[model samples]
Target: MTAEKTDTLIVGGGQAGIAMSEHLTDMGIPHLVLERNRIAERWRSERWDSLVANGPAWHDRFPGLEFDDVAPETFPPKERMAQYFEDYAKMIKAPVRTNVEVKSVQRCAGRPGFIAKTSQGEIEAQRVVAATGPFQVPAFPNIVPEESSITQIHSSNYKNPDQLAEGAVLVVGGGASGSQIAEELMRAGRKVYLSIGEHYRPPRSYRDRDYVWWLGVLGKWDEIKTQAKKKHVAFAVSGYDGGKTIDFRNMGHQGVTVLGITQSYKDGVLSFANDLAENIKEGDIAYLDVLREADAYVERNGIDLPPEPEAWDIQPDPSCVTDPILELDLKEAQVGTIIWATGFKFDFSWLDVDAFDDKGMPFHKRGISAETGVYFLGLPELTNRASSFIYGSWYDAKYIATHIGVQRNYVAYQKEK
Candidate 1:
């Protein structure tokens, strides 16, 4: 079959892909955006029923688009966020082809281009931009109990309280997702057990302003570099209930059992690390580091911001912690659900080129891939710290589109059917 050709081909029709397509359109460069399922499929299905953005709606936007005169300061629900992308696609007439799942991508053997094998057919292009998104696949520990009859589900699959069994839940990892899901379970009157780890505790509101506002004013996200993005990005404090800095404090008062990180599991017995106190200290240290940076910024800029109220109100409480290092038998403990909020891992195995670095993730100098005529979008700190977020992706998309538009050597690859 004759492959349809375009100047640029963008894979995945989420925020990143949409941003890329919009910028390319502005440059008068014909392009196509291919999505595996529907546009923003992850937000539509992968997220929980009551999920909300960590930041305010005002900052979540692509180029040539901003949140309308509605709920700018408030957080948007998952469904509304998904609708915004779909609506934006229609507003800008983005060339998005839904349900075009890409099987593999390879460089043309004899030309300077790529051939993307999709569910429909192959599509050839002079330049290929991968907007495959930040969250690709869920990552879980290899030591989880496989023989046990207990229900095991990743946070991505979790919808609401009714989806799980009527018993205690063992939530692993204490990052943003883990914390949020654990709280949701608790609100539903389920016994919740949350693992403690080195979590960043930036306040959602500081000095009568939202953390997102301060972050933008101080350029907090921009300080992170590309190298650090590949290593381990620090977890943000959950922004579920507005922008509160939630720790393990007072959780016990609310019927929460806080434990140390999960170490190993066997025969329905889960062993936890004896480092809960140390983990709490680690989180505190990270929190203080961020405050120091914020203070320095205020001093440097001579901004007369008022003192942060109740910033240090959350203190380490010994009562909130149970046995830090205990082995709990799932059946005996009445725990029927194990939710792993351990984050995600990207899969770039189908790319038949040297697009990955030492970590098996796509490596590029900004969005330009190692292979010529190939690009990567929607990655954290691809160029700046904001590159991974909704607003930040637009900058990366613009940069990639501008560079590709000026490249005169992008020759289309084609063969006679």
Candidate 2:
């Protein structure tokens, strides 16, 4: 195998990887991006045909180009987004080595650089960026019984509603993916069951105002202020929010049954929490109560309100109850399809880096990791709203590129002792 060398090497050619490539090109940094498949292949292959970005087009766009200037407010379809990424690569003339799967990435041990072993060959680089992001591995619940005759499939494998088995379909997650899948299946005339977890659910719009617009007002657009409030905001905004939420009011109209947590699936009998919505609704009510208290406190303390409404409150329907997960004996219900929308997991076994946290996430301060010459991008809360989103990835990429440039400059100054 021939050994190649570059100043910077990027793993994965997805949104994050492509953004980094663009940044490197702009900075005149000699780099190569290694992708196991064609650019944006993951999105192209994994996403369903009707899949649309939860975020608006403007927010979903990358750094250099805007997606559809006229309809920037609308969410772009998956295929269009894929095309946009492909066009981004061509526009920047990014140096990419497609079909090169990186088997392992390790420090040079005694050397100043790192070695990347790939299917094609070996490459050495002074700097490496693991832009693989999350969702590399699909997370499934172990509570699912092995003896069941039902066909189980992760959301990654699900394409269309027709692919699901006939009978009541139980979707195992309540997040964006699960909600959308459940809606789709229900629209296709299937009895859909949605298991509601403690997921984020934001209003689709606030008094005719888009949530993205409010996000800007809430300091989600201001990087410094947002980062400063991360500790306080982390817990509140950790789960899925913003556009990921489904229109629950319409979900009932569409004939989708929302249930609580799945306790167990044994003997073809699926049991769930009886009072799933009670806790969830109570939490929502408590949150609203807190908001009301905070508003009163602000008024008492003579705190000036921001431009938006200061005391806005939402009254959830007290009568609404999420249906309990019926104990369906596999033999009786004969349910065929079990879609686990349980969420995603990260796999980092290949990249032997010491910067990972206990959850296997790379420990980085605004995309710059502890290990010098290494960075992470396209992760939730990495910096701010842009951290996990495509638009956010560009911000992370720019910061990382600047850091790399600074490191390269310092390397130039350092001399062998």
Candidate 3:
């Protein structure tokens, strides 16, 4: 069968793909967007029942669009966010084809363009953008013993506390998802054990400004990934509970047993590292540093903001440091569930191109891949710290679209010559 043709073919109909389609449309570029499922499928299906966007509504949307009737300072629920994206796509009139799974994207034989094989059929395109984003695979650690009796579920499949077997829960990972899930389980009157890891602890709000706002004003959001000095895999913040600081210490006080980094499960017992105190101290330092930076920024810019609250400077006592539960027998603790809040991994195996690094990530300089005419969008640190955030989509899409336009124009000039 003859393949359908287009100037550009965008893979994945999530926020990233839709953003790319919108920009390409604005530039009068003829393109097609292919989605395996409905648009914003992950936001609708993969997220937990109580999940809300990590960023506030004001800072989480594309340019010139505000979340419908939602407070700027408040975070939108997962359902609301999914609807917002669907509405945004409709408003832009993006040429998106849902339920069309792209099988592979490869360079055409003796040709400059690419041929994309999809479930529906085949398509030839001058350019391609892999906007599949990062949350492709649920990353569960190898440490968990498969022979163990306890039931396990990754954060991606986790829906609600009622779905789990009746017993204590061991939530592995100190990231945002894990921390939130652990807290939710504890509040549900379940004995919860949270394994802490190297994660950032930033206040949800400082001086009446959201944490994301500070990151933007401080210019931290625009910092390139490679040049970044320190990076934390996850931030501890809860948007579901009206944007609250996720303090493991407070969680401990609320009856959740917070442990150190998970080591391994041996003979039905789980082992943990002895760095609970150190983790707390590190998080404390980061918390103070952010507040201090905010203070300095206010003074330097001569901006009127609220003074730092006295509670902000207070550090909790590291009670979990001295007598940390380094080991626990799954049966003895009545732990019936092991929830892996270990985050997600990216999969680019569908793209048969010589543009990946050792980790299978595309070698791209801010979405422009080493393989010409192949671009990546919505990956972590693709351009800046904000590259994966909802607000970052607009800027990254613009950059990718501009490159496509320039390349197309240059090719046309070469043909004329």
Q: How many steric overlaps are in each model, in order?
A: 0, 2, 0
In Å, residue 186's CA in model 3 sits off its true spot by 1.0
Best by TM-score: 3
- What is each predicted model's overall lDDT from 0 to 1? 0.81, 0.72, 0.88
lDDT tens digits, residues 1-417, model 1? 899888789998999999998888888998999998999999999988888877778776665667674477788888888888999999889999998888888888887678989899998888888899789999888767566788999889999999898899999878778888888899989998887666666666666667777778766777643444224634757658765676676665677788887888887788888877776777777667667767787789898889874675656565646445467888888999999888888887667777888888787899898888889999877987678889889888999988987784334345669
Please provide, for model 2 over 39-109, each residue's C-alpha lDDT reduced to its tens digit, 9 standing for 90 to 100.
88867888666777766776668757887542766777777878888889989999987899999988888
Where's the lowest-lDDT run of ten residues in candidate 1?
Answer: 225-234
State TM-scores per candidate.
0.92, 0.84, 0.97
Best by lDDT: 3
Residue 357 CA error for candidate 3 (Å)? 2.0
| Candidate 3, backbone clash total | 0
**Candidate 3 positional error at 359, Å:** 3.5
Against the true structure, candidate 3 reaches a TM-score of 0.97
The runs of at least 3 residues in candidate 3 whose Cα sits more than 4 Å from the true structure, single-residue gaps closed, are 224-227, 414-417
In the range 294-405, model 3's lDDT, one tens digit per residue, is 9999999999998868737654654565589999999999999999988888788889998898777689898999999999999888888788888787789999999999
